[model samples]
Target: MGNPKQKWTNEEEEALRAGVAKHGAGKWKLIQKDPEFNQYLHSRSNIDLKDKWRNMAAAVQGSREKLRPPRPRPVQDVPAVPSVPLQTPTVVPAPVIHESPADHVKDESGKDLPDAKNGPRYTELIFDALKDQNAMDISSILAYIEKMSDIPVPPNFRKPLGARLRRLVQQEKLEKVESSLYRLKTNTVETNASNQKDTWPRPHPPALYTKVGESLEEAAKTAAYKVVEAENKSSVAAEAIKELEKFSKMAEETDSILQLAKDIFDRCTTHGEILLVA
Candidate 1:
């Protein structure tokens, strides 16, 4: 290969800038051919000049971005009300509907029974219950409403009250605390919403849910311990089996030696008997 590429000097850079100002950007060949700047940029090809100009442009763009001011947020426009034509007002008679006599039926003593359709306002009762206190569980809230209200508490009051409580919590008028507990939002006595940042209630998981997680973690730990215990037992059994195998090999060797001794004794007895008979 030829000599390694050389770095651009101050003179070469100044000539490049002057050539670009005269001929505009992207005219690298013309800049290289220019007689006035050619002497300084003779070693740099058109490609080198193009690359250098691109790098300088990128640096200037980065500096501009850093010094740029933040854009202002746009204001929301109010919607205009539509106009209606003036008309002569007329008095209209209200429509009346006939009521069934069964609706107003009285008890055995001829006294009108209380209307079950118009039950106590659960929302107001909950707010009243939490007015003085910071928080209360479902049971305490029910008791407070019964103690304070003039009307007798219904036997099946809990179901409807629970539904109302859920609705209020969804609307952000009330907040649920730890398991079955509830409290009014901040500044709830005067305003439905508060301006404070901490007014929004943080979610609190039920004690039962937390207990379940703890139980699961404990169960996992127990299982891991059991697995370790089983592995240790298996290792002990393997060692026992190895000892038994060694004992079996020794017993086989002893039996072979005893058989060889018995055979030698019989051969000697037979040879002596033959000698005496001859």
Candidate 2:
């Protein structure tokens, strides 16, 4: 007994015709799976089927090019320009001097302008201090600013500081974790915390299974529900690990089969005689 003879359908032929017209052939495997191609021929796994469709498409395209008419070249004309006479140059008068750098040196009170770098305004000093602290909380930042400079920060300035912090948050230059607490944008500690209080809780020491069991037993005496829930979670985790191992084995087998099919398809399609048989 022999295998049944596979024939290409009219729909498959049309899909090959359109695909070649659009993409200009190649990538046969991709074309085979296309909805338009799949509607007629369903075997994407068979490379021989794709090769047949490609060969048919090539013949159709060759015939189409031969039948198409040659395009004509377009003609263009150059334009002419008129001649013009040149004009003479003229001299202009100089303007009067207005406010110069020396004129701007004094303010309305006739006092010399304060140095911007050494003598920044109260708000500038506060913001600069906040930046130096890497965006710390308002209280800590203000305290640090007072210690560093002689400038007195008014109560009203706190509102502006809050607004500046909000702007910095939007600009991604500072981050606000809680209502008042803030840290640098990069999540790195930039300053020494010698004066800072230890408000955050300490981390527990790393423990083995035996230590964990002893801890659970101790916790059960204090709270049974918490201990029971933890034990059940551990059991559920063990079951999940077993299921994951099984799924991994199945996936490996499936991948192996797919690779074998791909290798066979590659060999059969490239060789003409194998494709004829396929």
Candidate 3:
């Protein structure tokens, strides 16, 4: 015997039509899975039935509109209020004050000072001094400049130096280490070289003691000792000359030979014979 066919009642059809109208079609599976709408179906064989029902409902709605009465249009009694005139505010021009050519000349204290020919600004001189020192801190650099040159730097010059330092920091020529302390920004080559690892050839373990034919380690030690001895000798000769400079008892010929020997020793011992020819 064949199984009984599922039947959809009028109430169930109306409910489904309303559901499709409310939620649109193609989601009947979701509706069927819903606990509320499950009771409306007989066997769940009508899973594709929502699409069919929606199409039928649309056709019925279209056909029924021909028999239904049309709605009446609304009547209007009140008119819109007339717009009032708007006034735009007038704009007033601002007064300008002009100053004479003499007004801008003044010293740091804001007092009227004599107009000196502005050849080089204070900031330029400070920057030049800083550059000469390779971007040293202000105090040490000022001391060095004082010792080296007769340039007089006033106390108020710090203001211009500060301004120039700020400008150099902005331009990336110098970088501040801390407040008021700065150093020159190292070039790319310098930075890269510093970052690079030392890959130069170093003496191997065997070379340190005994290699191929000769003892390289002993030879290296001897060479290093000789270089140190030569350096010490040069230092002694320099001290002797300084001692002679203080004394009045040394003979002229003796002083001349000592100076000559000192010069020869300086060239030969200090630079390890390479500078002697030069």
Best by lDDT: 1
Ranking by lDDT: 1, 2, 3
Q: Extract clashing residue pairs from model 3.
A: none
**How do the residues 1-278 of candidate 1 rate in per-residue lDDT, one tens digit apiece?**
68676777756765676565345455678878877678778798999998887665544333434555552523121111100112112221111133222121223331221212222244467788898787987767777776665343433345445655765675678899898789987754646343341132312210000001112223233233333333333434365665345334333333222222223333335445432322
Task: Name the candidate, 1 or 3, with the larger TM-score value.
Answer: 1
Q: Is candidate 2 or candidate 3 better by lDDT?
A: 2
Clashes of each: 0, 0, 0
Winner on lDDT between 1 and 2 is 1
Best by TM-score: 1
Count of backbone collisions in candidate 2: 0
The TM-scores of all predictions, comma-separated, are 0.27, 0.21, 0.22
Task: List residue ranges in candidate 3 displaced over 4 A.
Answer: 1-135, 145-151, 188-278
Please report how far candidate 1 places residue 167 from its true position, in Å.
0.8
Query: Per-model C-alpha lDDT, please?
Result: 0.47, 0.38, 0.37
Query: After superposing candidate 1, which stretches have Cα over 4 Å from the reference?
Result: 1-114, 117-120, 187-278
